[model samples]
Target: MSSTETVRAGSGRAGKRRTPGRAGRAHDTREAILDAAERLFAERGVGEVSNRQIGQAAGQANNFAVGYHFGTKADLVRAIVRRHTAVTEELRVRMLARIAEPGDLRAWISCLVRPATRQLDALGVPSWRARCLAQFDTVPALRRIVVEESVATPSMGRVLEGMFRLLPGLPQEVREERGDMSRLLVVHTLAERERALHAGERAGTGWEATAAGLVDALAGLWPAPVTTRPLPG
Candidate 1:
């Protein structure tokens, strides 16, 4: 085909997809609703938002729009978590596959650590804008949903337990505590790194350079226990 023909074909495809009213399928509407929900849930805490509110924000007729895609408010919460959780899931599967023998601490730690520590470049996570949403979320249910749907996946917990067993200098309880802390630390790091990325973009500087600096900073915070004694009272 000629270059002009190719350009026209591509534009035709794009126009059809973007014009949801003309070409929209049930799945298209479902995805659009989810896209809207993800932004709203991330921006405003779940407690502060309701099913009716989500439907309105999604440009739907009534609360039924959200219910059609996801049965309940709780279900919608899970869907939102799934949007940001996908990369972590893929990373886990790939990392775990490499450690086929299982309980391979070194390889698995990268799986456990990499998802939250680095920029999600390949995926469109920058659009979900996870860092900002997570930082602002104060609703207990949203936090609980993320923890259950994303953090508490079976393989993830299994690898963490293996890490605890392999690294026995520290008690299992402390290791578990650190594991929990690691999740919070990851979220905190993302919030700070994302803020820097935004600032750099606004300043007309390269974002990749800023991302590199953030990665180095995250490496410094990895799970080496502090043996320093507490200060004397």
Candidate 2:
């Protein structure tokens, strides 16, 4: 039995034959709602989807099921992001531990890029998470939730620290620009791949190949020379 399945509320053979109790059923409902919401938000923008649509997709007869379980759209978005990040966090921690060369820029970049690509790959085709996350960039408020749930995590912090340690000469402004650039590169690239995969179209070779390409681009991007100019008076 799965971890969630182990929470049987009744006792004896009668209990075994009995349907899942309230807690287990509620857990299942929440997961169903999350799954439906993630796909809807991915297919449509976060702002474009409604709680009623999500609840209906999840097979809930009650119109307020989404609001009851998840509260608001932002809360629902956070839940979806957290669900995926939890897995990617594990992937990143494991990748961080295996880095034999702490000074290699590509090694650190791989730590940043691979976890996300690998997570999307593991989700297989038809998964909405990457596309859903891409939509978060369209809205500032929702974007912050994405940052908090994924980029602000401890593993991500370590990856950034290691990446910056090697670029000691980078200007603060350029560093900030490169940070945003790298984030956009990773998020949209994977999202596009996910979109293609979902549509049965080609999406490069695979997630590993895609990650290698990103690591290469980022390695060069970080160390590129910056041309400073005077600010307007």
Q: Which candidate is the best by lDDT?
A: 2
The whole-model lDDT of each prediction reads 0.58, 0.83
TM per candidate: 0.65, 0.88
Model 1 clash number: 0
Model 1: weakest 10-residue lDDT segment is 1-10
Model 1 residue 111 distance off true place after TM-score fit, in angstroms: 0.9
TM-score of 2: 0.88
Cα lDDT of candidate 1 equals: 0.58
**Which stretches of candidate 1 lie above 4 Å from their native place?**
1-24, 84-87, 99-106, 116-119, 124-126, 132-138, 198-233
Q: Where is the poorest 10-residue window by lDDT in model 2?
A: 7-16
